[model samples]
Target: MSHILLCFTCFESFRLTARNRAVRLSSVGKIAEKPVIGILGGIGSGKSTIAAEFAKLGCKVIDADKIAHELLEEPPVRKKVVSLFGQAVLDSSGKIDRRKIAEVVFADDRMLASLNRIIHPLVLKRTQELIEQYRRQNQVKAIVLDMPLLVEVGWHKRCDKLIFVDCEQKIRQERAEKMGFDKKQIKIRENFQISLDNKASLADNTIENNSDFSAIAKQVTGIFSYIVDNG
Candidate 1:
């Protein structure tokens, strides 16, 4: 519930502009033909749940954090990680242990930056590949990118449209508490990313997720309808 789930600044760390929703590809790789909608929000704001809604509505969803986890397991990536962090970051099986890496990075900015440098590019490469694949298939209706640090890391610039999930701080704090985060812990996590207001300002559309699941669903469906119709 911290701006991202910890260990995933791989523990660190959109808005749409324009009337067409998301037709342009500005990421500098092969242009994706379909709309790429980026989801933005603070930790505990139910961003993943929103992504799932889009998936259920038939969008091809890609989670950067999940992709990063896979990158850490690649043999070549492991070799580099070990070279950079030394063997202490590895588990008994010689794989890069995320918990061990997090312990080191969360307490040291330099290590965190180094770890991000090691993993982020690999994740972005895979992410872009997926985007191209989906674009090429012509079967997928939409592409939803659920990246926790999308804005902080500048991925927002590639998105055709971005949706910011806004929820009241008191409510978000309570949700974080239910997920085992105390107030101070929530603050620590939130501090790692751009402010919610800033995120909202950058988004093309904003959804207020201050209520129940059904209401959230309705809101998501509304936006989904817009994107499909507009795009």
Candidate 2:
């Protein structure tokens, strides 16, 4: 047998290329090996609950909110945030003061937009990394992107399918209150989100989440099954 030595970098590149080709071929099949389902909803619309239901069904849910929360603790992200919003937004330990930042941005549209401009790209990058990692392990049959601004930020384009979690405004308000959000703050936050009608119009499927958890879970399970069967 002829002895062959390959450089580490070359071997790594070859391995990555092979994996990429496999992923590409699987993606092109009628049933995409891994489908990415984007979940969109306005504030307090039970998006997390819907995501949890999908998670229970074995879907890898990469929640943008959760990722954003993690980013708050990242030193680079924290530094940039402090630079933009000032040191006042930092806590005693130099970590981000999320409450202060939230209060400021929610009250100012321009400020909120500026914050998103900084954070969204980072969030998307992290989201893609998580997606690829899940795919590498073959643990994700489908990935759920639970993003509140999925429609507003045009993330819908990145999704294979979009699901809108919906509920009446009153119900949303009630839920927000129970979650410890002040009524006024909830209203202010709601004002920042796009209209439910617009989100619903863009959705491939809509799950009405006003009633019972099981009702919502049933809808999610059905939709997930449909995607896996037909994606």
Candidate 3:
């Protein structure tokens, strides 16, 4: 459980699920034009911030979690989510109350997997389409996959380089609290993903995010440089 607290670090615990990489084909030509960098870290590790910093340095980020959030709002996906989780997950505005769903699913592994069963496929499909589109159009020079479960979902295979954002456990808990999650809730969120050790080991580079903003920013730049130079 402590490892779950240390790793996975998912703010929304139930978002962990995946299939193998060979399932989808990548267009070499599109991504070939530019390297695709995948960001990996536990939830609340400020991974999105690192990804954003890269964007500031001029990287086209394909934010998987952002795309997943948008998918929940679509009528077709919304209807499916409601059907599976029940109308209780819907708010007065008829929107999917993500927190409500998270509370229900995160408590039970089966329920968590069930929700993943529905969401992961759709998210993956949409993500692949976007990747293909971006590749086909040759629009972006560099691509960053800002996915929370990048490794779990096997999307890491597509990455030319992987960057792991390492943050202190205490700081991560605070970030989770800021996001409205209690300690237990934060633990629940982290339960679904792989270990931090393994995640960091898989990284081509590691960015320690526990210090000053400028220090973190400098590391982010270094990673960008490494990726660009090696890419």
Candidate 4:
């Protein structure tokens, strides 16, 4: 496994702090009326799985990457992307070639910033709309923000509680490899965002995901119950 995976050495500190915060929240009987939860984890740490578990418990999930993909399909957005990156970034069908875009942006900071400038605002607006829509619904137990760069983009500040999904470094690298991401590719993508240590430090809860689905599910269920009961 790459050393990059093991670089987040502050997990124990954050884990303890998060537990204390949870205890304080429980003792004070203070919780978000309709909690907006943010998930933080390293690549392939199963953050989506964690969000899915929350969904099963009645939380509405706002997937920023999915929204960004939808935005990329808009004609206006396509035109802007074409203007910024030129026609070479588009496929034969004229859709934005995300792989090509990633190759371009991930290799250069300025290009990535330019791309973010075009896509982020639109995604944020749509996310807010969905959040408000879900918030008004009586059955929604919580709102989960499943954004890849949640903390890097400052969306973590908007969350009522942040959950860090912890998995062993070796397991995370293997998972990312199974997803067609090589170690170098994973490192490059992660480099653009906030560190795992920082993300964990901001978390109010930690869910260990180094095991099977049942284990993760039980932990997520417990966290969901805790948030609903006391946050």
Best by TM-score: 4
* Clash pairs (backbone) in predicted model 4: none
Candidate 2 RMSD computed on C-alpha atoms after optimal superposition onto the true structure: 12.8
Question: What TM-score goes with each of the models?
Answer: 0.82, 0.81, 0.83, 0.86
Weakest 10 consecutive residues of candidate 3 by summed lDDT: 1-10
Q: How accurate locally, in lDDT, is each candidate?
A: 0.77, 0.71, 0.72, 0.79
TM-score of 1: 0.82
Candidate 3 regions exceeding 4 Å error are: 1-31, 136-139
- Candidate 1 lDDT by residue in tens digits, 1-231: 223354345333233344222333434244245788899998778888899999888789998878877778888888888998898877887777776676677678787788788887778889999998888776788899999888777777788788999988788788778876677667766766777877787787888889889999999899988877766
Which ranking of candidates, highest TM-score first? 4, 3, 1, 2
| Model 2, global lDDT | 0.71
Kindly report the root-mean-square deviation of model 3 from the true structure over all alpha carbons.
6.1
Candidate 4 lDDT, tens digit per residue, 116-208? 778877888899999999999999999999887776665666777889999888999998888767878888877766678867887878999
Q: Model 3 over residues 122-208: C-alpha lDDT tens digits?
A: 777887787777766544667778877787766777776778899999998888788777888877667677788778876768999
Candidate number with the higher lDDT (3 or 4): 4
| Regions of model 4 farther than 4 Å from truth | 1-30
In terms of lDDT, the poorest run of 10 residues in model 1 is 12-21
Clashing pairs in 2: none
Clashes of 2: 0
